[model samples]
Target chain A: MNKNINHLVNETLDSFAHLQKVAAPDGLNERILQRMNQPKGSKEVYLFRNAQWLIAALVIGIVCNVYLAISYNNKGESNGTETSTISSFESHFRLETTTNLYE
Target chain B: MSELQLIAELKDGNQQAFIKLIDLYKHLVFNTVLNMVQQFEEAEDLTQEVFIQVFQSIQHFRGDSKLSTWLYRIAITKCLDWQRKNNAKKRMNSMKSIFGLDGHQDIIPDFVHPGIQLANKEKATMLFKALKQLPENQRIAFTLIKADGLSYEEVSEIMQTSIKSLEGLMHRAKENLRKSLEQFYKS
Candidate 1:
């Protein structure tokens, strides 16, 4: 009987411990509510709204670099062609002058 | 709001609905967390996180089980995750420092202070300490059954186990608590 009474006391004590005495912190509910009221970030928002400017900047930079590289390569090729033409013209003139003198 | 309504609003990012859910179930979550974490403030934070997860994953609820049961599972998993991630070793070390042995039963003063102020609250503190000593699953089962007043079937569903398995868990939990109490009262 004594053991049974003691068990009851302990059970009561344990159950009381489980009772919630602590309250949730103030304004935390409001804070969670506010976050919910705000729109969640969507995929479209991520693509166009969040990272669009950075992506656009990267694309523009790459295009400009490619255009510059292609134009520079073409300019070098054209310059080489002009140099070869001038050299060939000078050689022809030299050959004609030599042939005339010999004759 | 009803649990179903909370689930609907949570899926839609309705924060007030979430607040209402928390207000309704915070005690249950906090009690479970307090058993797992033991620290009061940390338990409260974990309780909030459990609700956040419920909000984030409300769509997955499927309504196959009671919302309370599902939330109980989520709360328990969150506690385990937080423990494994944040403070597993620190907790063990702190326990060692306090008890002078790894996993020794705690000995709060037994005199009872001749009716201490807020005696219920003081005993509650001791109960929390005793709860910390229980094995992981036993603690979970015991808290879900005793603290939340969940039916055995509900507990089985929340734990994702058979009813027979929950009975075994509850039996073992009771035995473990009895043994721990014997040790606590002896000192």
Candidate 2:
């Protein structure tokens, strides 16, 4: 048993001795060159590259929209108050002028 | 021309330089990957991928190591990645089988390397089986040294380790392989 095991181990260990190197398959270089010549970036990579810029632009647009909306709302509120005051004064002036004309 | 000239031309994206590079190292890359992966078709694909990667990344070569050394690194990495994916698929198949889903188990056929002599084919097959059982580092060290005909110094450089550490890994690999082979014979 010991001898058999020892023989097996030695045979397996020496199995690669005198081994020859195999050549690459025919036309492999052509295949590889073809693959290399294929347009470089895949759709996924292209999308990923542009995704960063898309996100940044989206964020910037949202921020600018929010700023404009807030300022417009503030201006709208102030203009509402001013328009109401002017309309009230104009109504009083019209009433006095009409009373004078009537007298 | 010279190695430096070839590298410079490759860096410059010269087509003739690229073809020359392919002609020069394709066999080395193929044989190394074949020895590691043990399947001709997969080896060929992985070898092609390695060269493509080399072409894409040549500008970053920096010439710190021999181009062959860098090629070996890329080829080995691609093989390891394939192995990892294959193992994951096997695990998924096993899980699906346990759940009684439609999962087909991969039958690992015996691999006889084209380069081995007829007399050694059987032993080499069993040896490869036992080799597949080794840890990644041990398997890489052993394959690069014994099967791929790389010198110890070259393997140490490729593996980026001291010769002493590589020796230890090789010793452990052989011991483990012996144990595995003994079990095979016993069975």
Candidate 3:
């Protein structure tokens, strides 16, 4: 049995013993050269990809700042108008009361 | 030009020298990788990758061994890495299926090595299936010896193992392959 196994194993492996070296596919050398000649880092691609996001973020931030500034100014103007209206009404009421009291 | 001159030229960014280097060793590297990976397209890609790596890192090669030995080392390492990544992907797919995340199908290795003779194709395929079941080192040693036709001493340098240990590995590999083949024939 052992001898049979050895014979079988040898026979099987012997088939592979003289495997003709397979030629590389056409254009393999060209492909390797192309890859080697490529620019090393994806720095340019990375910058291009992030450039869109960076611009979007900057625009968002600027818009938010502008909106907040406009809203704040509007609030301040409304508050001032309210205070002036209240003061004018108070002054008119006081003058009417004083005039009525005097009469 | 001498290999040393080629090395120097490659280090100096000489493209022609680089092409010469690739032309010289393309078959050796491709065949070694093909034997290991058992897939022509993947082997070709890996061969290109190995030369690209050599091209990029030629400056660090201190000439500790023959250039062929270094090339074999790089080729084998790339194959092993490819296998590991492939296995990991299989595992991930299996886990995904197990967790009901996705229905993942196993990758059937349809390796038809081009070098096998037409008469011996079936038997050689059986041997390759068995070879795939062997441990990585054993598989590598046996393939380097049987397929790449490297001597024990040369394989030792490429594998970074002593000759005795390489012999032991080869022996065990043969035993495992025999057992696998026996089972295969029985079934």
Q: Which candidate is the best by lDDT?
A: 2
Task: Sort the predicted structures by DockQ, highest score first.
Answer: 2, 3, 1
Candidate 3 structure quality by residue, lDDT tens digits, B80-144: 99999999988898888999998587666767678878887777887888889999999999999
Q: For residues B1-187, what per-residue lDDT tens digits would candidate 2 score against the true structure?
A: 9999999999999989999999999999999999999999999999999999999899999999999999999999999999999999999999999999988997979888998899999999888888899999999999999998889999999999999999999999999998888888888
Query: What is the docking quality class of candidate 2?
Result: medium
Better of 2 and 3 by lDDT: 2
Q: What pairs collide in candidate 1?
A: none
Off by over 4 Å in 2: A40-103
**Whole-model lDDT for model 1 versus the true structure?**
0.69
lDDT of 1 by residue, B1-187 (tens): 5667767787897767777787787766776676567666667677767877788788788998878778788989988788676556667767787877765443434222111246465655565566666777888887777765678988888888899988998888777766766666656
Residue B72 of model 3 has an lDDT of: 97
Top-DockQ structure, candidate number: 2
CAPRI grade, predicted model 1:
incorrect
Chain B TM, per prediction: 0.72, 0.98, 0.95
Q: Worst lDDT window (10 residues) for model 2 chain A?
A: A81-90
